[model samples]
Target: MSEPYEYWLLDLDGTLVDVEWDYVRDVFDTVGDRLDRPFTDAEAETLWHGLTGSRNRQLDAWNVDPERFWTTFHDVEDPQTRAESTYLYDDAAFVAGLDEPVGLVTHCQSFLTEPILDHLDIRDWFDAVCCCTDETGWKPDPEPVEGVITDLDVETTEGTGVLAGDGACDVGAAWNAGLDAIHVDRHGPHQRGHCVRGDYRVDSFDELDLP
Candidate 1:
């Protein structure tokens, strides 16, 4: 960004860390088995990365019950196995050096997110962490972002803040909350199927043009 931001909020899953393909496949397989349908590799990738756009929309198109699929996914995933497979993106280490306050706003639930943070020894990096639940109203709704900023006690309205993430919902959440957004395009547009607009867009954290 050309201007300075007072604080930062970031998405956790695809933005900062990603589980290995083997783990990704295993989780999807379990979900598929429970749902009584098979998911091809392409389908799994699209859902896992939310490459096409809204995950619920994708699930709806597949005739899968969004609530049921999520319940099964969470139940099938082993926290320890997920932590073991998860690896932090090298570029994401940039967050550790940020002088401003940083918080996490992720759709990855707490049970899974906690272990990943603990395993990476990065739990202390964020002043606050908001794991979106049904009550928090998921991203694209400003509620969860509002919750995190409240937790961080960061200046609202007057302070410049930005949320960076690998998904369109992250950008939506930022914009909805009246904050700037950084679209971390981990997957190229070709793979993501469409580009997500943001105040700033970069392929890696190292590419952020912040002051």
Candidate 2:
């Protein structure tokens, strides 16, 4: 028998909103510039995505201080203003409008997350908004997800809820929290196929056949 989905947990970037990485890329460039060794656009793109874990290796090789580098990067990114650059998907709005109780579970910090939710006028749509902080941690770890589940007065029992996001960590977090996983393949099959091996897959929120 299948588990009943009593609640829905949603991811922000790439799942509900299309995040243009230009700003993020700029942050990467700024980091390089500050290091007095600038990176090419291509290099910035590679480091931004870090497909081969090369970013860390390069940082290590450069002897870049992780704390200093990331602090500078985050300062430049200014997710508060950057949130304005992202646009919401119609299907995401549809999902958010659903009558079911919904919780937002994201790796994004509350600084960015809160502004984005308010800008999109979906702040009140969620029963809970669980965001990562300096101490709260992020996805692929179950604490954030578990926090939202607790806020909703729901247990992290199997089939009790669903986690929908655009990355593998989302699914892994769902598994860790004992919730069903739904992978939103916004990048289509080729680019993101390997990242998703969840209970359900959908190219768009409209295609999601949730109950």
Candidate 3:
């Protein structure tokens, strides 16, 4: 954008920070063992990174029990450990400097997200943190983002707002909510297996030329 947004919404994991491969593999290993179905590395990557686009859709295709898997995932996930494993991207530092109202609208639940934000010491960067859930709906649904918008208390006219993230779901949510989307492509096309279209696409926040 030529100018800064009136208000901004951001995704958490993948967009700001990500857990290590060892952690990802470890989590899946535990979940798979419990499910009695080990996941291949490709499957793990696809699910973890949303490379296939929608994790729920992928799980459905594989006949995985969504409720059971998520429940197990929640049970096995260690908030402190995941938070300790998370690291902020170098380019993502600019978000802390943003002058306008900023909100976090993410699929990361509060149990995990709170620890991660505290771990990174970036909790103060957001005016509102809307952790997506059954009630609020996930990204690409626009409901959670709208909840964050309500929390930020910003009036938006067309083209004056934006949401940035590292997923197609983020783009969908942005457009669906009538805001501009900034697609931060952390994983290259070859790795992700496809491109995520958006009003703006970048590999790094350094490319935004924020001032």
lDDT of each: 0.91, 0.73, 0.91
Model 2 misplaced regions, further than 4 Å: 1-4, 37-65, 188-193
Across residues 110-167, which tens digit of lDDT does each residue of candidate 1 receive?
A: 9999999999999988999999999998998999999999998989874388999998
Q: Summarize candidate 3's per-residue lDDT along 15-61 as a digit string, tens digits.
A: 98998989999999999999999999889888888887888888999
lDDT of 2 at 101: 84
Residues 118-157, candidate 2: write the lDDT tens digits. 7778788889888765476677788888888889897655
TM-score for candidate 1: 0.96
**Two-way lDDT contest, 1 vs 2, winner:** 1
- Among all windows of 10 consecutive residues in model 1, the one with the lowest summed lDDT is 202-211
In model 1, residue pairs whose N, Cα or C atoms come closer than 3 Å (at least 3 residues apart or on different chains), thus clashing, are none
The C-alpha local distance difference test score for the whole of candidate 2 amounts to: 0.73
Clashes of 1: 0
Clashing pairs in 2: none
- The alpha-carbon deviation from the true structure for residue 186 of candidate 2, after best TM-score superposition, in angstroms, is 2.1
Cα-based TM-score, every candidate:
0.96, 0.82, 0.97
